[model samples]
Target: MAEPHPVLITPEWDAPATVRALCTTRHGGVSTGPWGEFNLALHVEDDSAAVAQNRKSLLKACDGLEQIQWLNQTHSPRCITADGNSLPEADAAETDHAALACAVLTADCLPVLFCDETGSQVAAAHAGWRGLLDGVLVNTVKQFRAEPETLHAWLGPCIRQPRFEVGAEVRVAFVERFVGPSRAEIENCFSAAGEPGKFLCDLATLAALQLRALGLSRVSDCGLCTVDDPRFYSYRQHNPCGRFASLIYRLP
Candidate 1:
């Protein structure tokens, strides 16, 4: 009601003018306390009515978005085509139809949006550690009919390397999962935290490497850190935090 906080982000990429994308911050919603304002996720124990109202406000703010297909986001590599008629259980979604939005919800996990230079199709992926390790980015690239080189990707805000500390298993996961001449390059994205066996992972850098591995040359990042930025909801900072939305759609 009070100007909706106005924290939406438009990604900088080589996407055509017909492609529309934005990432919402934790402002401009009716939820109270922990959920605070502008929490778009329904699974985070926020009041259903409040979440509904917040979602409605989001729709009003984004022009030319007829419908946004919200996924369950199981942190898997599963991706599907958005039809705007049914809610699916997947981490990524894409659409060629105009005004049908492909959306994903995240608090700390990386949200990656995709589009071809031709502006014919657009996609959004929820790339958490598990999803990223499982190849969600690779699978999302496969969904596009165009060559991977022609597709452009934009990395949204997430937990940065300084705050995202993980166990040794996380480091092993990437090292073991991606073994090659460039494996060391991938390994460089993780560094030992102050604690032994604990490591700080750069999710954005890992995501960029994954995109480059997929032959996508046009990749850009919003460079916003969710944990450090109070404008966003950080699950690591608060267990019962709200979730934000990263969405993309084609304009008619």
Candidate 2:
């Protein structure tokens, strides 16, 4: 028998007024096979019925099923402010609009949820390596219309440093984008992998650097490693695994 689905909540550092955030695990939904139970992604090969049930369960666990803006992530820096039922094809979603939740699906990519401390806005992003390298996080902060320093960031579960391998070209891309002595801080986020032309990348640290560069010092990470933790889905560890969801909503 499959285990019950698990739901992970962020700490107080991320709990802005009316902002409710949670990351669902693979344990609770109705998906079977490699996506066994609780796979919320409609793009996966799971039974449509199973995916529906998983989504239903997730909505019940997080908030009432009104309408959440689910993005069609393309690993790009694009972000859209959604107001209705239209599922926009973008990498991030945000709103000061009440009752409409913002969400993203992920296996190993970083799912970042954001809200201004003043409860004026909320947003979520699927920041995979490509998205991150291309400035998705920075673009996300801009969506709130506040100085990046006033926003709070909570990084959901993702593949950790020891398991996230990247090429030298990836590092070069980041170095070229970053400014000042902080260039070394970005480089230090990578470690020498045994393989040439490759290094171990730290997604969390990279995100922190980006947040710091934007002057946001209140970022807090959940510290859960998707690849290292079996309770969550991990694309790097299991290529065919189902994706879990990270959702955020503001109360009316």
Candidate 3:
């Protein structure tokens, strides 16, 4: 077994054997400034060497670095399958290979890990409000060949509803896409911000709703609030912040 790094572990329905999943906390790398200690994002202003070292550290924590598939996230609803040969430029990655891993990076956006209890497949997604509104979760499950009931999901760390304030336009966008009690559900996800047209939104609950809409009955979330938790790197709290990652893979 690999030694535990100072990170957050999120276990889905399959705990010990079928698969493993985790989201890194900004607690154990060589980054500085707003990026702080454990920034894994390449696009951030942190030194490339530091980012590389952080990645290496993460790989070590996860046991090995053979086939981890990292995506270039754009906050779109695009999801893809990856192998060791090539990388995909999308928000989510799913795979059935034991050696291959699927990963998603985020600061405040929701990072979702999906897998079957039987260890048949696994997927990871980065779902910002934009992606959620545009059907990213729905698209991700659609890409999964596994039956919905057989799938288990885990929501990693993200901005909490209390700290994630948004404008009315953002609420309207989600309202337009969501139906039924979804209006209330969507409204309930938001708390009243001091401003007239603004509200505090809950990314986790929104993601859970999305997963449930996709027929995934088994969903669990870490409930770790990025913006509120100092251990996490939050873009909303710090304007220029680093990104942590949520990764999933079947054991080889």
Give the top-scoring candidate (lDDT): 1
Q: How do the residues 1-252 of candidate 3 rate in per-residue lDDT, one tens digit apiece?
A: 543255655554454375878878888777888887888888877898988888877877675446678888999889988775665678988888886789988999999998886877889999999987887788788877778877889998898888888999888888777532367788788788998989989879988987886788889888889888888888878878999888888887
Model 1 Cα shift for residue 52 (angstroms): 0.7
- lDDT-better candidate, 1 vs 2: 1
Question: Which pairs clash inside model 2?
Answer: 4-27, 5-27, 5-28, 29-38, 31-37
Candidate 3 CA-lDDT value: 0.82
lDDT of each: 0.89, 0.82, 0.82
Clash count for each candidate, listed in order shown: 1, 5, 0
- lDDT over C-alpha atoms for residue 28 of model 3: 71
Q: How far in Å is the alpha carbon of 32 misplaced in model 3?
A: 2.3
TM-score against native, each model: 0.96, 0.93, 0.92
Local error of candidate 2 at 168, Å?
1.5
lDDT of 2 by residue, 228-252 (tens): 8888888888878898888888887
- Sorted on TM-score, highest at the top, how do the candidates line up? 1, 2, 3
In candidate 3, which residue pairs clash? Answer: none
- RMSD values for the candidates in order, in angstroms, are 1.5, 2.3, 2.8
